[model samples]
Target: MDWDKLRIFHSVAEKGSLTHAGDVLHLSQSAVSRQIRALEESLSVTLFHRHARGLILTEQGELLFDATQQMVKRLEATAARIRDSEDGVFGELRVTTTTGFGTLWLAPRLANLYKNYPSLKIDLMLEERVLDLPMREADVAIRMKEPSQADLIRRRLMNIRMRLYASPEYLAEHGTPSTMDEFGNHRLICQQAGAAQVAAGAELVNQLMTHAVASTLTVNNYFGVLQGVLNHLGIGVLPDYIIEDFPHLQRVMPDLESGEVPVFLAYPEELRHSKRVAAFRDFVTDEIFAFRRSRQTE
Candidate 1:
């Protein structure tokens, strides 16, 4: 098949209008329409249903569009890899992780990365949903659990636990809870049961709620929980990783903690030789090491 015609057809199907696709492809509307017609003739299939409003893809068009989309992603990934310098990393790196880790841990430490690779462009996507690494949804991922995706090179970064914490002032005024039974005197701040979170975290919050706490505050993410604790709103259930960054928080009832959650850093196996991915992987590893060292000294 004619690659140029296929490309034009893909663009037209995506935009749902020949004029719009022509605008993007820098081709005249007549030229784009001619390409689409030629492509349909070669394939002997109706690629689109033309209507007064716009073009709608037929079943065959949908299939072709899917193939073209994959082709585009692969080409972009290849281009990024090519743009990366062997001696110095450059180009865009899409890194993804949970909101808590991205905001509290990774994002704050990114200054060092930028300092080392000034040319690097980082797109940090923070969300609870796991992005498809192999499909190029994201270039790298630091996940709370081991990634089960195929064709991924994964390494266990660290283990974290959901632990109870409170501000010094809050503890001083309300008194510390030495045991689970004493939790009744304090407000329990945590992620809501239905919120998108690791199962272990939600389970820990569930366990704490059974203590008959007098008051409660539930936030969707750990960032909000941290805010509530810092403001002395209540005792919060938060990941232990925050302790190094937030030394002012005091661990409440040291014995009450959730099961350990393993943290993993992963990238697609195809990105093994990518300098950008290597730089980011090394940066995160170095940061984790520094974090561990600081905790040891404390």
Candidate 2:
């Protein structure tokens, strides 16, 4: 199995034409065809189905293509690690976290990081999905719960709890609910019953549902719920940390909240010495420290 042939085969399968693959590989079409033939002969399988429109992979070709895709991802991961080996720290860093936190919290504080390292590039991926840090689905993650993934270095950043909130204007219009039973007079906004969210948040919303309400609004994420609350749509269940930035949000039932959801920052153990990882880790740590200090001062 020659690596060169596999490389050419991968390009040919992707492009669906020998001429196109040849163009990318800087080889003649005939030379690309020769390599494909040699690979198929060695493997004893027809790798493609030729047609008027384009080439389509046979069953075995699909298997080979999948393997090559994984290989490419692994190679990219290796290249990233090698590039990050430099202590200069001026390259791309992929960061992943929940949509609500990424958009509402971390994204705003990232300016300080960029101010420190002007040339640094950040690819922030915000989703509910848990990325595979060790396999390099993302370079690092800030998650509501500690990552259970093995071979990762993790640090507990902080804890958050879900609490009810409403804009002051909305309260001024509809008046405030002074008791749990008084919630029956206002519309309640929250994450949909089965949407992806931390257990504590869902649990708190679920408990709120047990009580009667005047109306109901359900969103899939906290960002939308925040919008609804801010616009005077309804009372929303939101994380406590958001209050630091949105102080105008009046707390409803200040004594009621979800169980503590621990926040953690994690990266692959192999990236322990990566300058990019170190830079991001320190930036986040400094931000959290500042956040904590602000909380105390208030």
* Candidate that would win on TM-score: 1
Model 2, total clashes: 0
Candidate 1 Cα outliers beyond 4 Å, as residue runs: none
Q: What is the C-alpha RMSD of each candidate to the true structure, in Å?
A: 1.3, 2.0
Residue runs of model 2 more than 4 Å from their true location after superposition: 15-20
Look at candidate 2 and give me any clashing residue pairs.
Answer: none
Question: What are the per-residue Cα lDDT tens digits for candidate 2 across 118-204?
Answer: 889999999999999877889999999988999999999998899999999999999889887888889999999889999999899
Per-candidate clashes, comma-separated: 0, 0
